[model samples]
Every structure is written in C-alpha cells, then in structure tokens.
Target: MRATAEQLRALRQEVAGLERWQAETTPRRMPLGHAEADAALGGGLEVGRLHEVFAGHGADAASATGFAAMLAARLGGSLVWLRQEQVGREGGALHAPGLSEIGFDPARLVLGLLPDPLTVLAAAGEAARCPGVGVVLVELWRMPRPLDLTATRRLALAAETSGVSVLLLRVEAQAQASAAQTRWQVHSLASVPLEANAPGHPALSVELTRQRSGPPGGPWQMEWDRDRGIFRAWDGGGAALSGPQLPLAAHG
Candidate 1:
C-alpha cells in the first residue's frame, strides 16, 4: 500500500516521540562510548541491576578489583564498598592515592569490613536499598555455599527497587550459577606506554561470559585512562591525542 507524503510524515513523528519517551522513562545505561562495545551491550551497561565481575585466576584478582572500582567511580553519587575481612587482608586495602590516580575521589568512598560472607551480603543488601547511593560494590574472595540463589536474588531485588547499581566482585573465584544481570571475567594485559620507557594506564582483557538481556560478548581489549577514569576500546597501541574522546559525565 502506497502512503501519502503527509501520512508518512505523521508516522515518522510518532515514532520519534515514542523513542523520546522511552529514553526519558526507562533507566539510563552507561556506555563506554566505543561503538562496537556499546552496540553489543544494547547501548550501554544497564543501571539498576546486579553485575558480577570475576577474576579468571589469582593473578587477575587485582585487575578485576580495579575494573570494578572504575565502574563504581563512574556511577558517581555516594559510593559504598563492602569487603570481606579475609579478602581485605589478602588483597590489601584500597589505597586512597591509588584511587585518585584512577580518577576516583577518595572522599566520596565509604568503606565497610565484614567478618563473613553472610554479613557482607547483608551489608550489601542494605546499601543497595539506599536510593541516594549511586553504586554499591561488594568484594567476596570466594562464594560460599551460603551465598546461594536466594541470597543473590535478594540483592538483585534491592538494586532494582532502589535503582542502585550493585557490583559483586568475586576474586580468585571460579564461575558458578548466579542471578546477576551480567557477568564479566577479567584478566590483566600489557599496557601501552605514553612516552618511551614510561608506564601507561592499565589494560584489561575482558569477556562478558553471561548476560540476561543479550548474547555473551567480548574478549575485547580495553584500556583505562587514569586521568579520565574511563575505559576505551584498544587495539594494542597508545591513544591518539587528536580524536573525539569518549564523553565522561559527572555521573554515568
């Protein structure tokens, strides 16, 4: 059926209006601004959901922790970090100066130490219920038997209801069933230096092993910008100074 010009114009206007409404009403996503990665993630990482970051091996634990920290920093409002005592003892505490180097302000960070996994989860659940907090990060050295499906579900529900992003960081842990909206496996890779013989921002070898809304993605090479505190898609080289940089808002 052939439509008149006026009919076609009306249809286009309607579609545009619908899109605008969706953008305003639906929860916003935080994009890395790398075209390919953003497209794979259906625009960006979904807010108000549970995300799991797992270290592929013991050596990758630091990389995973840094990755999770960057995510929390990106979210921007009051941040809470709950760490299991054993994990803190083994991995050491998050350094204030180091966090600043990665673009995270140490002043906005709140730290909590818990003796056991159950207590850590309880704290995370409570933090996730706070609408004022932009993100809550929980570090568990290993997932114990007590952290079963029900426990994860409770965390997920709290995040969704409160519209707070929750990051579950499992260090030196293996893959297992989870109720998280997305799961990422991280490993450290060689970073590209800015000048001859000088160190550069760290690189991460990341793979999306599971996602509730999209096909598993990546094994993408991504690099961090210490100054900007954001990740960019990398192909093993130094970032060009003259280019359109990814937009980093005060709040993601």
Candidate 2:
C-alpha cells in the first residue's frame, strides 16, 4: 500500500531520531597511553572497532606488540594475546621490561598461542563477543592468506557490536590492503638516550608509518625505562637520543 505524504514524513522523522540516538549512545574511544598517540588516533582507539597495526619488518613486530599491550593495559580490561605463526617461539612474548614499568598487571593478561591465523581470528571474534573479555590482540605475522576486506569487515563488525577493542598486529611485509578502521604502519627508530640526572636507559624512536584519521609525520621519539618498565617521550635538549624526522605521507 502506498503511504500518504504525512505518514512518510513522520516515518522519516522517526528514522532520523533513531540515527541520532545511536550516534549519541554508541561508545567509541579507548585510551591509548601516550597523549600524542591518542591525539594522533583521533581520540584514542575507538572502542568496539578493529584497529590494524602493520609493522614494516620483523624487527618492528615486537615493538608493535609491546605498544599494543601497553595500550590494552591502560584500558583497564582483560587482554587476550593471540599468537599467530611461530610468534610464540620468535620473541612474541609480551613480557617487555617496559610493560612492568608502565603498570600492566601480569595477572590480567591472557595468552593464546594459536598457530593458525583463521583460528586466531575466529577466537578473537568470539572473545570479543564475550562480555568479560575487554581487549583481544591478534598477531598475524605469518597468516597464509593476506588479510582482505572480507576478514577485516567481519572483525570490524564484531568489534562494533560487541564493544571490544581489537588490535591486529601484522608484519609490514606480510600485510595487504584491508578494511580496518585504523591502519597504522609502525617503524622503530633508535632508542632514547639516558638522562644525566636520571639513572636509566633512554627511549626508542618509534616512527608512525601511517594513520588513517590523523596527521602522520612522527619520529615520535619515545623512551622506555628499563628499571621503571614504562615509556616516556624523549626530551631532546638533554642527553636523550633523537631519531630522524618522520615526514607524514599523503593518506592512502
């Protein structure tokens, strides 16, 4: 049956109200530890969304994993680390000295050593659906098939609906195009130098390769204190080490 103009107008208004309510009610924002990183991420990592971290090479994988773990710790939720490939054997362990310093409780961490990428993805989705689990980290360095839109969309939808923050850790060499909300490419620079007044090691040079929503250039020089087990920004004027300038690239 054809609807009259008045009825159609009323229906449209109802739909609009629903849309507005959803926008206002949906919670989207996870706290990334670093202020700069959070700002760069457009108000932290969006809660209930899939975030992809692509490390340009093998060396960057550990840093990416550590960084993701740190972020998870700050969000105050249970962390599920899904190990893909031989990530378990190949220094995929999240026990960075920096983590302890940064205040991440070892007890709250849950580790899953899944060699199969598909299995890992499936489990991550399931964990996200579970109300108790807060964050799920899927390490996909050695997945057989490249991540494409289909897989990413599935994860993204799961995150959105379940209100879980998902981090996809991929090797830069292995990563292909994906439909993730945030595709971050990470590159490690040199470590930050130890300060004269302080009695510890310096920070590391972490370059932001790509950010989907925010400005990209950052030799975002950061420092990880071994003794303290935390990361801090390097103050360049002191004896701290400084990495090369990271120029932002045009959005892909």
Candidate 3:
C-alpha cells in the first residue's frame, strides 16, 4: 500500500523523536571490576557511549592502549580498533601475543590502520554504528583538525544508536571539549611483584577527569588479572597516594 505524503512526514518525525529519546537515555553499565572506580561511575562503565582516554606521557602510549583494551574486553562482543598509522610507527604495532597476554582474544579483533586521523575517524565512525561490534577503539596520537566536537558528537550518536561502546585512545593529546560520556587520563604503573620476583599483572593508574552523568572519579590503582578477566582494586602495596578529589558538580 502506498502512503500519502503527510503520513510519511509523520512517520519520519516519529522516528526522529525516537532517536532523540534514545540518545538522551542512560546507557547500560557494566562493572569495570573495581569497587571504588565502579562506585564513582555509578555502577560501572557506560556501555553504548563514547569515552576518551588520554595518555599522560610520551612513554604512556602502551599503558593507555592497554587500559583501552581491557575496557573493551569487558564490554562483550567483537572488537573493532581503528588507529592512526603514525601510532604504530611511533609507539608500536598491536600484537596478537601481547593482546592475548592481557586476556583479550586476538581472533575476535578487527583492525584498521589508517594513514591519517581523518581517515581513522571515518573508519571509526562507521564501526561505531555497527551493531555486531561490542566496542570500537579509536587510537590516535595528538590533536587533529578533524577530531573536533562535531566529529565526536557523530561518533557518540552512532554509539547510542547501535548500542556499541566507543573508546577513543588519545596519546599525547590534551583534554578538550567533546561529547565523551567519560574522559580519563591513564599512565603505566609498576606491577606488583610475585613469587621468585616474577612479573605481575598489568597495572595502570587512571584518573577520571570528566563524566557527563556523574562526578569524576579515580586516580585509582588498578591491576588487570588476565586469568580472571577483571580489574582488581590495588594499592600496589602502597604504591599510590590518594589523588585530589574533584568537586561533585564537576560533571554532574
């Protein structure tokens, strides 16, 4: 049956309204496995939203990537990671063995190595809208002209519509305005020692700088347990100090 022009117009408006409503709705949260961090996040990380992770230093690229990978691992489903080509040339390439060492499956991963940030963002935008993907990791170094607020908003919208989590890994980039549901600064930390002075699990010091729905949280000491597939609340045997707290209204 053919629809009249008015009926079609009404249907379009209804669809647009529904999309707007979904964009405003709170995404489902998944426990990130740390009590303190989870509490600050109001349960856990918000799935189906855009989040940012900025590396704290030149040497922290690996740490930031690791943190992003761990978060992606916990989010469920296949992982699609889009990274600037320069990142691999400067820092290192994403290795299968290294990924497996941290409990993420190399088999379920899809990667896009793009020449520039714009291309990377283009690929990421498409990946974020894919319902088959559980997480989309956009790894870029420094600030790029194309990654403005407008690009981020589109990515966030894609995430909301597809119920896919997007984690933007920013190495050597300063914080700026964006549509990220949460923003973080992450750096490497010494792993706890083991029996016979063996290597310990992956450890990271992450600070929550901004959150859209709640107050910022963290600067927590987190150690990822590969065998258990969870982040354990760690002090690193007194390896960290309490970070200065942010105002409750900082993001709320």
Best by TM-score: 3
Q: Per-residue lDDT for 83 in model 3?
A: 86
Q: For all candidates, what are the clash counts?
A: 0, 9, 0
Q: Could you list the CA RMSD of all candidates, in the order they appear?
A: 14.3, 10.3, 9.7
Q: 1-252 in candidate 2: lDDT tens per residue?
A: 599999989877865865575587756676444568667766666776777776757777766766666557655688887876566677545564556565677677788877587788778778877667788888776555735677887677667666778888876455566657676666665554344434344344555555555666465666554444445676655654354344578895
**Which regions of candidate 1 deviate over 4 angstroms?**
1-25, 237-252
Count backbone clashes in candidate 3.
0
Per-prediction TM-score: 0.82, 0.71, 0.86
Report the lDDT tens digits of candidate 1 across residue range 48-128.
889999998988999999899888887778789998777756788778898888888889889888988889899999999
**Cα lDDT over the full model 1:** 0.82
Clashing pairs in 3: none
